[model samples]
Target: MDLQSDLPPLCVTCGVCCTDAFFRYSCVTPEESARIHSLGFPVEREDGREIFSHPCTRLCGASCTVYEQRPATCREFRCTTLSALEEGAIDRPEADRRVSLLRAAVQAVRQLLPKEEKIWALRARLYADPAAAPQTRLALLSMDILADRYFKLKGRRFFS
Candidate 1:
């Protein structure tokens, strides 16, 4: 049921990462700095502080406007590459719990995210393989512990 291991790559071309959907995007290095500028965007400014926002205006029709000159954040923000996303370590019961926890966390972060059927599909996949990823399996176990503790502390079930 480990979804990450069995599911093929899902390119979320919907631009969720580009907008203020979950987290803000920023660049620090000179190369990244250059990349942002190359996109024909002005440096993000807030209350006298330079800050970047997500969902760059450069996105056009479900794609990056400046693909080659995109910022380093866009380049490195490939979460699908995470070991958790890989097939090997994603089939344990803990892995199932981790996927469930991730789904809860993601839904808590953005209800719209769960509306995407991809979430349900991935949730079903967390137990697809049992012997592939031990470390991820352990991390998933820890995430389950944290998720349970979080629910107890908050007094509300995120998924329920």
Candidate 2:
């Protein structure tokens, strides 16, 4: 039996959650913080809670290097599309379609952004810059809409 094949393709191949696509930081328990820090990824303290910023160093082409030992948040999180697919609210094709759309949207935004600049920084700049390209603003909006609709939990996305 091919157990891996039975799993959702989007979760395995589309690792937007590991990137800066949706969130800036993920909350972790104190123990998770210690372990993740030991693994050489910097953990920060925020409002007495421990967090690790995204675009995770452990991600290598959509795969987590420390997947088995990843933080509890990483282990437990399920994007809205994944949840819908698992719950039979949407079929595999639809889930995959959503993933593809989000990926393309991210790519559009990435192409419009300056090299090495963070997405959040770009968003801030775009928001304040009156003369920014219309295409860039449109790309940002497309990415944000897809991320909000398919991945982010209600009221939980960055800059929401």
Candidate 3:
């Protein structure tokens, strides 16, 4: 049996953890690195470790295209929401509602920023200069707060 089959179904509908919203990169072993590279994904070496940036290229919407061959980090990491669901602490509908809210917030932030811009870069630009226009600053702040709430709800930490 596939171990992933036992995981909460919400994982297939939530891509927050894969979008660089929670983690900047996913770490991989040398073998996994080679596999990802062979699959045409861009991999980076940092501190002697292989890593892939978030908004992972293999992510197709809310699911991973390389699910069967995903890196260990991806396979092992579980958000609080998923844990809760697995333990029957929250029902599927509740999990879906939470994921939907997070997805809407993410979409709102994407709409507010340039289509090609990375979220971390936009966040840094907003943080580096407080002199940005009030509206822009407000939008960034709102996005930050929403992101924080999403992370908190997922039982994860917002690294920013």
Q: Best lDDT goes to which candidate?
A: 2
lDDT of 1 at 140: 46
Better of 1 and 3 by lDDT: 3
Off by over 4 Å in 3: 1-8, 133-160
lDDT of 2 by residue, 1-160 (tens): 7543586456667788887766777887876666888887778788888877878778887678787788898888888998997788987778888988998898888887788876777888888997888998889889988888998877564731
Where model 1 places Cα greater than 4 Å from the true spot, the runs are: 1-12, 45-50, 80-160
Candidate numbers, best TM-score first, in rank order: 2, 3, 1
Ranking by lDDT, best first? 2, 3, 1
The digit string of per-residue lDDT tens for model 1 on 36-90 reads 6655766765565444655466766446766666666566654322334344544
- Name the lDDT of candidate 2: 0.80
lDDT of 1: 0.46
lDDT by residue (1-160, candidate 3, tens digit) is 6554566456667877788555678887776767778877788888888888878898889987777777888787766666776787877777777788777767666676777876677677777888865665676567567556434545555542
Query: Per-prediction TM-score, please?
Result: 0.39, 0.85, 0.79
Q: What TM-score would you give candidate 1 relative to the actual structure?
A: 0.39
